[model samples]
Target: MSTIDTSKPHSARMYDYFLGGKDNYPVDVAAAEQVTSLFPAVSQMARTNRAFMHRASRLLAERGVRQFLDIGTGIPTEPNLHQIVQATAPDARVVYADNDPIVLRHAEALLHSAPEGKTAYVQADVREPGRILAVARETLDFTQPIALSLVALLHLVGDEDEPVRIVRELVESLAPGSYLTLSHATGDFDPETWERVVEVYRKGGTAAQVRSREEFSGFFTGLELVDPGVVLAARWHPDLGARQGGEEIPLYVGVGHKS
Candidate 1:
């Protein structure tokens, strides 16, 4: 396991702080505070994003997606991807990947699988799509449909990291009928406030880039989008009982099928 760096703020840890999780350090708290000071609704946005992940995971599982590969999995919050999907389909298999060593330290919480299901965690960065897919194959069958979830993750990946290419590589590795579920923070609603938030993250030593709606939609260039495509995070499948009145949340979310 890599050593956990406490000097500089990490996106995963900072996110944990936003979600009211206690797994973060002082550095993360400071950075999260800076973000909140810039955008008061940031914490609400984080919670809403998490709710979207739960809804998407359960919907895919209900639609017969038995395997899930969730990259950029943050600190283990209760009712994680495996928990949500496996609840609907106990035989569901889930593989989680994240680069944060602190997340790795708390990975035990993520490994509690349902008796009929299985779960595994990989300490890998999203940039290393090959490694993630390779390890995920050990648990998830690449020949069957799998839901590739990148929830509230890509914004931390700057343009230089080639996030779209990363998504393409991961999606290409899955079989036909595979699904891609993504939720990313966007600056389309309030670009100026988001710009300041990005600078806060950069000064804290983390690469942050909020995208426009068009740029966010580019990730699903070839895949077929599901109903109510590319809307605010809360608008995607709200029948799943996601939080209400999230119109101000500056995040774009959608799920697509690889037909």
Candidate 2:
């Protein structure tokens, strides 16, 4: 296992800590507390994101997508993507990518796959789409439809990084009929709360780019958005699975088909 640096708070660890998980350090807890102070709904937002991922993954698996590429996969939490996908399609193959070494150390927990399914983890930053795609290709056949999920991830990639171009590159590499499911944080809900939370993350060594609703939708350009396009994460296909209600947490979620 890699040695975890408790000195600096990592996003994944902070997220895990917010969700009341034990996979984080004191620094992470401190960061979470700071963010929560700014936006009291922080924990609820994290749980909502997790619930969205579960429903989206299940919906994709039911739609016959047996392969998944999940980027910015945070600390291993119960009922991770693989569990959701494999439960629906036993043969599902999933590759989880995260920049945090702590997640890589806990990758073993994520590696536990159903006998008929497979799970692998790669330690890579989201900006390196080439490396991510190359490693994902080993488990996911590019020729087949793959559900590329970037839930609660893009906001972490700021403007200087050209998030649109990064997403386009990854989407272009997939075959037709592939899908992109994502949920991103937005400032459209409450600018005051958003800015404060952004400052907290920025101080933690990562810049948070809380995008506008239109900016979030822009990521789906050149693709057909699934029905009820770009609604709140909780509102996307609620009937697909579990629904955890929280009125204050704001997130935009949508799924698109690569035509």
Candidate 3:
């Protein structure tokens, strides 16, 4: 059994709390509530970000990409990465990687793949791209084009880690025709409220950093941007059902394909 340290707030559990799931602890709730109080849109951003993942996965599946590598996968929310992709391409193969032990505890739900498809989970961090790629090969074939998903993740990686290098390293490992899709918390549009909201995570013992628009877009360098490039989460393929709201979502999402 995986040990969960409930005394401190974890990013996965805090996200589950925001999504109105029962998998969160009190500490996570308190931390999430603190952030919500600072920026009411925090919860809404969570939902919007989730919706973007679904849309992005489906888009990749539609492109005949059957393999996926989802890093920083949070607690099993309804319509998880596998469920979404399997619905589109029942033969799709997926590998979920996360550093959280609690997420590993609940990974059984993620493993429920279609008989025609497959799923695997790796207890690894995104910073160790090589480790994740090696372990994920148990389910996904690295020779084929894969949709590498970093949804709602990178911000947790502090500047000292040189986040751009981390991302580029991962991108370099994938085969061409592979897709990279991601969503990031940014302070570009509304710096005041967004910065305050980030402080809540820092106060809760989580080191988080929100990126600027230019910085966020840099993650997709050297890749072909999908149509309607680098837009707000709600604007990414809205025909696939985006959140309904007039306010700007704090997260920016984009999908790009390697040539």
User: Could you list the CA RMSD of all candidates, in the order they appear?
Assistant: 0.9, 1.2, 1.3
Error of 2 at 152 (Å): 0.5
TM-score of each: 0.98, 0.97, 0.96
lDDT of 2 by residue, 68-108 (tens): 99999999998989999898898999999999988998899
Compared with the true structure, the alpha-carbon lDDT of candidate 2 equals 0.89
For all candidates, the clash counts are 0, 0, 0
Residue-level lDDT of model 3, residues 61-156, one tens digit each, is 988999999999999988899998898899999999998899999999999999999999999988898899889877887788999999999988
lDDT over C-alpha atoms for residue 71 of model 3: 97
Measured by TM-score, the strongest candidate is 1
Model 1 residue 174 lDDT score? 86
How high is the lDDT of residue 3 in model 2?
69
Candidate 3 segments whose C-alpha is farther than 4 A from its true place? 242-247
Estimate every model's Cα lDDT from 0 to 1.
Answer: 0.91, 0.89, 0.88
